[model samples]
Target chain A: MKREKVVVEKIVETFGLTKRYGRQTVVDRLDLTVSQGEIFGFLGPNGAGKTTTLLMLLGLTEPTSGYAQVLGLDPRRWPLEVKSSVGYLAENMGVYGDLTAYQSLAFIGDLNHINGLSQAIYEALDLVGLSEVAHKKTGQFSRGMRQRLGLAEVLIKNPKLVFLDEPTLGLDPDGIATMLELIERLPAEKGLTVVLSSHLLHLVSRVAHRVAILDRGRLMAVGPLEELAAHAGVSADLEQVYRYFFKNHSQVLSEATR
Target chain B: MKAIIRKELADHFGSTRFMLLMSLVFMISFLGVFLAGQGIREVLAGGGGYLLRDRTFLLLFTAPGAFMPLTAIMALFGPLVGLILGFDAINRERNQGTLSKILAQPVYRDEVILGKYLAGLITIGVLLTALFLILTGLGMTGVGLVPTIGELARLAIFWLMSVVYLGFWLGLAILASIAFRSVATSALAAAVVWILLGFFVPVLGQTAAAALTPLEDPARPRAEELAAYDHVSRLFSLASPPALFGEAAVIMLDPTHRGSEQALRLSTMSRLDRLLLNRFQGVLSVAQSLILAIPDLLVLIAFSLATFLGSYLVFVKQEVRSA
Candidate 1:
């Protein structure tokens, strides 16, 4: 929390960002913004459009109708530019089992056209605490190690912003703590903006400066935890704030049906 | 794109399945060539130089041996290599959840597919070249005859065509990989396509051709009927890649094989005229052989490009799910 110079520049912005697969709207009209140097959390359960929205922002999937900007570049028009600057750790992301950790990072480094590749790979692996097994095949890695390798893959590119989707999905407690610590250090130590998406409320609250609660492709509430909790008339705990919004949303849905 | 191509090449070359498949192809080819060489040696020993014919060096590939010629074996099983290399190209990545990770980078969708297809093509080219070189070495030692420059040129052209022929299968397998979600489904689909096009379609072509143009006199069909049968059968067989490869390979490998229709027309010629025609049919120069085989070459290239383009379009437009 270095707040010496508080210049809130919007790192990501979207207006009416909607994504529909045929008749189903996976992501509805949504306006959102993330400032530079903050961990933005996208909190939603499975099939709630969290992953879909992340894909749209990364320009991996085109939005049905709407606009998205990543690092001041329109994602649809400048996908490569946006992607080059933004690292994305997709949900359930995996590594080549046959490839050693070093080889895997080397491939990513090559893709990003990183100069001094060997040095970069070493730094990335060391940062994720995976240097001990750099030569070991990734197929032998545990779930936590693989997840950490995925993070190393992101950091190897030295991206200005990173989108991490359920990065600790199947990790043990120790693994989760290590992953969180790595994430928590990104903003301050590396000047990276992180947009972390997960359904785990407490973990997100631990690292994310702001969280956006979504349900059924719609944004329910978004703000700092204290601000959101205050708005929802609940205590400043993410779990309580999340329940407050979700309960009201369900009631609103039932009323609309009636 | 270069990075992707390099990575895919490493994967294809290092995989155990690829090693097994390569060895299988090697053993089959070695057996075929060895048998052909023994048959050639016996003829040469019996002072049957006339029977051995021109382009004797090329006989190592086209001569019948161990149930089938080396060319026939290639036409049948070369596709398996391509199919195995590409059947799970995209889907396996999607299944392992690595596709999204790669796509999320600065790499374009087309680059991914194009790199994969190129890697597969390069692998096929290397495999075919190495196989041919080894067979040629065996032929030199066994037949005790050095290949003339003309024989060498024809061998080179045949090798290039084989690469393209197998490249078509690689493209089709990649298309299957992109179209199907599950790796198992794509693998099954590729195998099914290989069987349908390689074995079933050629047989079906013969059946359809016979049905379309039945000889009025089965015991001794008229020349016109024979010509009609040849024309109709060739037309049907051309629909299959293996048949295309086989037909084109004949003209490229055997200089004296003028054309299928030409051979059938000889049946209508007077006995003396047929004899003269057979004698004068002489070995075609490599340039002439290439000119004759251009149509098949173009078609094979088109088939390969079309399948690859199909995969590209499907992949670019398809939504990438993060699984």
Candidate 2:
């Protein structure tokens, strides 16, 4: 079974990746592996180092010690190679308000050094239902519109894998539903692997094929949501299983902070 | 890098702030030319036995009446141009949360800084070149005479020197942006340093000279009695970028300004003696004036390179955390 999985080419793999700032270790010795063409949820609460881990995996930030591979290339050794094929949508990411939506997409195309991308950009914008406002300045965009534009910005390059960090952050109920629908469709429609990081359990439960529960820089559990819930003897839901895993220490930490 | 430069250029050209700055540069240059043209008209109307009445166009650079010359105005405003170009280059992007998004693309992190700095330099070059061309055109129409080859060569050198001088402020502002996370804080910091270098240092240098080397007899101060004051003041003034740029630009654009240091030597020169010196030096080769200004150019280059190096060191080692 392990040999078959190796033959299929795991999209992400890490062996004890760690990051430290001064004396505080944000991401401890973490061993993680994510397979290809599946929506993998990296579930954690605030201050759980999800963003830092994603940054390291994307080669935006260097890890203090450990190994990491994204799409068969070590991100530390081949950052540009990994980044060229990986689309990252950061939490609360901003659009260039000065530019029209079309111009912003064109600018990203230029930055990526892609040639003859007008058709691809238009398709991506239409995919996100932003074609109507393609010529409008992004400064006037609502949060939902901007969020969709950010997704379009990522999708325009036709990345092999897409990492969405808190994709529904600061969105209204309607916007959240739209974003979740888009996230659900990303892997199925685009033949792309996804690493969706979020704090909301029910949202991750809705779309992610597999989930990893992280607390205070340490992995508490990993596997399919049903399997983790069954193993922990809890109801087959993300929130219950997550609570079962972090029940030992999160209470103490929350109380101490309070 | 090309993409970054193109975007930056678009941003600058489209920005109302840049339009206002360009308008200011245009208005000042035209006013300087108009005022200097009136003086040249006076010389033509038998005002005085002025030297180079036929070459009255040179006065537009050397002695614009009741105002600093066009080159001086540029030297004064050049830092503002540079500071505005880069005061928020890094911080604004970081604040907008676009820095990480852009860095996550295929481009290396260094490319962002390199592209932005090059954009500022290119903008400075274009803006100044346009102003210089306009000034040249105005001088031709106002004075009704085209500049000589030597004058054009001098103007070209002055243009290059102004770019280098402004580059110092540009680099410093970018460096400030990199160090500070807030755009407003970075802008205020850049403006503070700009004021210190552009205005305060020169003023402080004169005050220091007056206090340290007070002439015992204010009635008739000897050249030797004031030598200490001149030397001290020049030393302090050279520490400021504008002083270095202004001194070099004046030397190149106005060939008649022998050297600021030659004052002590020429203090004993009578009116006729000065006239004779001007007549002899009016025919001085371009190479001579260029050689005289080389030291100031070197100093300006050094300042620019140092600030660029500082920015590079801070930016390369800086970490992009989860903002």
Candidate 3:
């Protein structure tokens, strides 16, 4: 059963994935898998290499060593093909401030060589609840609006999978709720697999079907919340499970550095 | 790439920097025309309209600088226009957090840098075209001098030369933007290079020549010694882009300019004396002048291409995630 799952329908698979800068490894020998139409939360403390791993998967950065396949395509060998099929909303993603929201989406559409962009652009905007402000310049947008616009940009390509990095950073309470709701609904409504990386364990626990805990560039744990919680001999609380692993794994980091 | 180019062109045209710089250029162009017109008025008064009948209408560009001529002004200040337009092209995108987003899109890596550069080039082309048309129109209306077909073609050639000259600076600015992370740092770096090439380099060339080949009796050196001194000075200045472009423009615009005797390989004095014996032969033929400026033009083009390729390689090889 596990072999069938591994070979048949996995959307993301990385084997011994590693990234190093000079002598310091930022992502170390990570083996991970994400099935289609699942919310995979990537949990980490600061400097845990979450963003670097995402960059490697998206072909923005190359791994020092390892094999990664996204949606059955190798990012290193076929980046454009991978990019066309997978959407990525980078941490602190930027919009062209002088461009109207509609224009920005259309620009992304053009980059992807998407034909008949007007309807797709409008649909994407509608999905993000920014339809009313479609013609407004992005410079005048609030933080929430910009994030939504970014979501619209990601959605315009209609990819099978999306990677959203810290999508709720700097958002207000209401904005956070909106962004989280959007991410949660993407799998059910759009049939899109998602990899969401963030430090907010509570939020990830609420929205993600499975969670991976990372610390110091290593995959500390990866599984459903209850499974990981039970394995750690803790209650099915993501914070407890994360803390249990963090406390255990932080020593490995210090030893490696030493 | 087309989308990027369209967006960049819109941004540059709508920008306050382009507007401010273009207005400055516009004002300077008008002032140049006014100054040249006043000089022409005195000439026409002294020698009548028949005196300039045989001269090409493009002579306004190479007009002897009673005040600084238009080509001279462009040579001096054109780098500012191109530099300001391009210095912040990539770094601003990086700072605003847009560069990574663009890179993440499904396009080849060179598309972004190439599109931005093409946009800058197109913007410059438009500005120069407008300036050329305006200057030609003003010459016709204000001074009642209409260019012949050959003269118009020469003007077009000069316009193209101007673009190539300024493009070298634009490419340098883009390279600086890609190499540096901060907009301020890139702009300052580009400006400093511009200042060196535009002002300091030529001055340094003169100082270097004086230091190396000091003439004890500086007032009246022998002909061969003076020629040698000029040759040494020219050699030093050749490293400067403005000096190269300046020599090319002067030669291309004024057909009578055979080139500096000390720097040029061929002595044109005999040819000039032979041509002067014929009343209608004060200037070299158009083909001859083009041949004279070909080497200068080739050098300018080669430098522009080198800088452009340098920027291209830097941009393609850079790590976008670092931004």
Candidate 4:
């Protein structure tokens, strides 16, 4: 029964997805699957095509080759439908400074045609611990406060799946902890499936159920920490597991050249 | 789309940038019109033949003020409002990272551009309507004259033309915003275009016309040479949006304005012909003014639609990824 559920609950599936810009390939032949209710981490270095892949999945960008199914719909054919069902928290996403937190959420709600907007705004604000600052203009918000509001924006959409790109990029330690805790609780509390893309492995390790490490537009490894560690013949820690794959890649390159 | 339009309207009306610029335009235009009204009052008191002129009330716009006429002020500065409102419309959203967020919603991509364009048009319409109302009120009280229904109709058409003219500039600004990545670059581009079209074009046209239509006699030029000079200069001036607007507006506001052909004939008239010329060449009907102005009006409309369509095409085809 558990096996059947796992097989039936894939929320994001991409087959050999490839994106190229001019002569440079940004995301290369990536085959990935994200199951429902899981915190799937996309771990990579800068320029590893993590953001490109996310954009392609959201249909904001067209892939050069391959296919992706998001929420049982091909994003290319029905981008509006795919977008409506998904919440995306962009890196460095900004709210209108002139609008209060509640107003910005209301604007988003109206655009998405969401009903009971006030109720949704209040609930989302409370969940993200921004209820007290709901009336405050976003321009005056601290970085941590803004990051929490971004999460609230995602929550207000009430999406089945959410994509968070570098959600804790500029936050302090306290802010990071609060954000991670919020992310960790989302699946259980709201029945959401999250795909988090970030370069900070330690931060992602705390919340991600399974992770895919990518390098130079290629997927290096994908599995739970224990499974990745066993493959690398190292202890089950994300740092060591990550190093094992990248370090092996260099050795393989040297041997082939030799 | 409606939501975007509402948000944009609120942003435009509430922003200090827009308010400051709008108020500056209002104050200057008010000062110009007030000066014009004072002059008109003096003329009214003198009881000159101006009273015999049809649509004499419109002189408040056409009459020379302390410096420039109200029409000249609008011709020079009205484009600034449209340019300022739109120069940073798209790039600012990208820089702030809000564009991607908005696109991620269910909203169609076209809605973003269409909504913004409509919001800008609405704001321009409201502000221009308010300005005309205030100016008309001043004219009625300060000049102690009530406009006839025909004059009001002419004024209404002039107001619509001004909106369309400013909209052309707005569309150009939006095009610049989409073509350039930085807000400063787009702003500079729009300003440069405005300068080229508004200030430099007329001077350039004069120089070009003189070169193209050289006179045989500098002191006592022949009728044909003068006619050719006027034709060539007018042709060159038509290249400018402001010039086009000025031509159409002058005809619309002044009912006595026959087409350019009559103006040319009058300039070439002998002294006896001038004295024998009928004193009662009655003012043109409103229908006559519309017919005379149709060519300029059509070109102005085309200019507006082409520019807006250019921006729409560029915006819809643009990649949403922010650098």
Candidate 5:
């Protein structure tokens, strides 16, 4: 009997990925995969190696062991290729303080080598609801406006994959809502695959189709929200499920110590 | 890469820093022209008798002094501008959380470095050229004198020398910026290095040499003392920028005053003898000057290349993060 070939749909894959700073390991051995056209959220608290993992995926920082591949290209070896297919926005992303919103967008659009750059910039600005402030210097922009501008940069390239490390990090409630809506629409509207890492588990659950929870440089759990909730013996609420995992792990450590 | 370079140039020109530097250059150029005019008038009118006597050495040395303030700015800020261009080249993007965004683009890392470097080089080149034009205009107008073909050649050499000098400082700044993550820290490091190279190194070298070889009293064994003094003087001269620059200026300005005793003695002979001696001295001085310039140019280029390569490697290895 002949066996059928198994096909993998994942656009990003990491195997035993680790990063260390001197004696302390920031991101321990980890395995992860993000399927094509999916919104994958990475959830963790502060100092849980969320940013380090993202950097390694982007090939901005080298991993201590193992490797990551995006679009079937090794991140460390073919970063430019991986990068070209992906758009990314890290926490607290800054724009050139001196440039106006329009100027900054045009400049970034040019760098991305996009066709009809000026039109793309205008469209990005409009998508972010920043058209009114397009002429204002970025230094004068509010935190939400700057975040929107950063999102515009990610959107201008029309990349297949996007890495957003805290897309709404410093935004207000309304700004957060706007950002979440944008994040939710990307996959369906643009055929984009997104990997978003954030400490806000509830926000991640609301916007993402699948979520990976990391704690202390290790993956605590990863799956669809409902699946993780079911496994953790919680109801439909992902927030409660995430809390249960952390509480359960802490209780086990405490019990062992006693 | 061209986009990045264009953006950088736009940012640099839009900055207040460039405006302030331009203002400083203009002020210095005007002052230099005024001084040169006053001196030239005195010499041409022959009103101040014996003013030119024993003053050729002083004149050659003092010409550099007129431009010292401008040269000092080049030595000090060339590195500063380079550091500013590079320090945040990657880190700011990371801090703004845009590094991943940029890296995700099609541009290569080497392209980013090259683009930024080219932007910086262009800015420095434009500034230097503007200053040179200003000086040239003033030299011609204020003194009412056009440089001879030889003088024009010497000025071209001086302009080339300035680029090498500025490159040394700019390269150091780039290295400092790459080595330090914080812009403030990088700027401080570059400033410290500039201080050492510009102000302290020559002074320290001279002090060390003087301490090693002491001068004897003029009263005892004049000839022997002279011999020992000459030997020590050669070593001391090596420590002096004024000495090196003076030798260069003489060959450039006169081209007929090579340091040979026979040539000097011939100048005091008949007019025909003096003319022949001047021609011989010009040829000899040109050769000697070229020999001296080789070491200076080599040191400048070597230091610049070392600094530039060090900065490039450090930047390549740097960890990107949003902080």
Candidate 6:
């Protein structure tokens, strides 16, 4: 007897989404889907339009053309609704420098209209393992501490979909392991669907069920880690598969130009 | 929203910025009062001489001028506070990658903007009110001078006018914050705009009006010339809050005195002698107060709305990630 495949419940869908700044196209025409209860990793190199793409999906930035829907609502027209259902952690993940860890969490909880905000704040602090220093001002916090606080802020609301952009960028090895554990636990523990972007293929492969590789403003490749590795004719190492794909594509483009 | 406002007030009061602002306010107000008191004391000690009499009137007129230096200081820093408070209102969250986190909950963008603006306004309102109370307290304690009902009425109008004045700068700051990506750039942009609107534009307006309608003979008895001067002066003065505030304060302080020879001549005539003194019997009605107040209110509202709407539009169009 075969276990049933979880039906893909689309949480986010985009059709021909494009974004341009001045004369430069940042996110070219692209179609994408994020299913409910999946940790989807958006893998990209520097300036690969990962952040820009996520911003358009989050309705924080408008697309030049095409449509985006988050939780079945057009992002442009119903941004507030889309935002309400989605949790986003950007690249920098700045906490209110002046606010204490506890105070920052409380403020964000209040903004989100979260009930039992004090308790929620404490719980979030504990989850991030910053409970001991929750009262310390974020300005005094280390980069890893700020990153944890940023994650705590997102978790405070218990969002349905979480967007984490380089969430563990500045964390130490221990912090990274803690964050990875937290991310892995989220989908099962809270029924959350996460869409995180990172250049770290190993990290992405460990947690994400499905992955989309972005190069420049275009989609380079996408699939499950194992399938993508097999397709690249490499060992079951996501990093090696990613490098191989990119290397071959660039080599092909160079040869074609010659 | 209320929670946001409470948090903002807490943050403002907790920050060193509020302490600096309070100190500045106290310093300016104390200086104004001390100067006024010294000038008055000197005139009284001079024993009713002609110069003393003229100086008493000048001292009263000059009370409004004290607000000028204070207004300049406020204009310089007001936008700085607005930019600092609001520039990162959305972008910092994006940069910190918390924008999505906050938005994922049940909050609206309008609520965020409204909450932030409300917090800023509340902080400013509390600061201004505290300053007003301090001034009133000092006046009562130091000089044994309790403002009369009429004077109190004028002070209220002056306080009300300040909201508009501050609102203009606040709106500009918000616009700058939305337009720029960095807080430093926003602060600089707002300061430049402040200097232009608060100082340069008003001076330009005065110069243009002066060139258009040069000052006529001060000794002239021509009513039309005097009316043109008054109209032009009032119109030019409307370009700056300090000028508008000064005019409003003057009207409130001495509603019957319109800087006319008639008011001066009437000052010399006794109440019973007024019947005999037909030359000094030009009655200054309450109608003049209404006329003066109406324009001041309209101009303040118009400028406040322009700045507010401009800021709102910019905020609405702003990309969260840009900041």
**Chain B structural similarity (TM-score) per candidate:** 0.95, 0.90, 0.90, 0.93, 0.73, 0.74
Write out the backbone clash pairs for model 1: none
lDDT of 2 by residue, B1-323 (tens): 89999999889888998899889878888888778877776776785555552235567776757776777777787688888889899988888888888888888777888789889999889999998898889878876657888788878887888888888889889999998998889889999998898899999999999999999898999777688888889999788988888888777766666678875657756788888876666544568778988998898888888888888888867776537
**Model 4 regions lying over 4 Å from their true place:** A1-7, A250-258, B265-281
Better of 4 and 5 by DockQ: 4
Maximum-TM-score candidate:
1
What's the lDDT for residue A218 in model 6? 74
Which candidate, 5 or 6, would have the higher DockQ against the true structure? 5
User: Clash pairs of candidate 5?
Assistant: A83-B104, A93-B96, A93-B97, A94-B96
lDDT of 4 by residue, B171-238 (tens): 88988988888999999999999999998988888887789888888898888888888788788777
Best by DockQ: 1
Q: What is the lDDT of residue A62 in candidate 4?
A: 91
* Per-residue lDDT of candidate 4, residues A1-258 (tens digit): 566543559899999999999989999898888999999999999999999999889998899999899998899999999998899998888878889999989999988888999999999999999999999999999988888888888888889999999999999999999999999999999999999999999999999989998898888888777787777788888999899889987542221111
Query: Which residues of candidate 3, in runs, are more than 4 Å off?
Result: A1-8, A250-258, B48-56, B64-66, B261-282
Candidate 6 lDDT over residue span B1-323, tens digit each? 66557776787779786787667666765676556655555655776364331123323323433343333434444444444555555445555545555444455555555666777776667777887777667656654445555555555655655655666566566666556666678778777766776667677766675676665665653555555544565566677654555455455445554543344444555777777776543423335554655666677668767766776677667665633
TM-score of each: 0.95, 0.91, 0.93, 0.93, 0.84, 0.84
User: By the TM-score metric, which is better: model 1 or model 2?
Assistant: 1
lDDT of 4 at A42: 96
Compute fnat per model.
Answer: 0.96, 0.83, 0.83, 0.85, 0.79, 0.64
**Candidate 1 local lDDT, A35-143, one digit each (tens):** 9999999998888899999899989889989999899999899999998999999889988999999999999999999999999999999999999999999999999
**What digit string (tens of lDDT, one per residue) describes model 3 on residues A22-61?**
9999999988999999999999988999999998898988
Cα TM-score of candidate 3: 0.93
The CAPRI quality class of candidate 1 comes to high
Q: Which ten residues in a row have the lowest lDDT in candidate 4 chain B?
A: B47-56
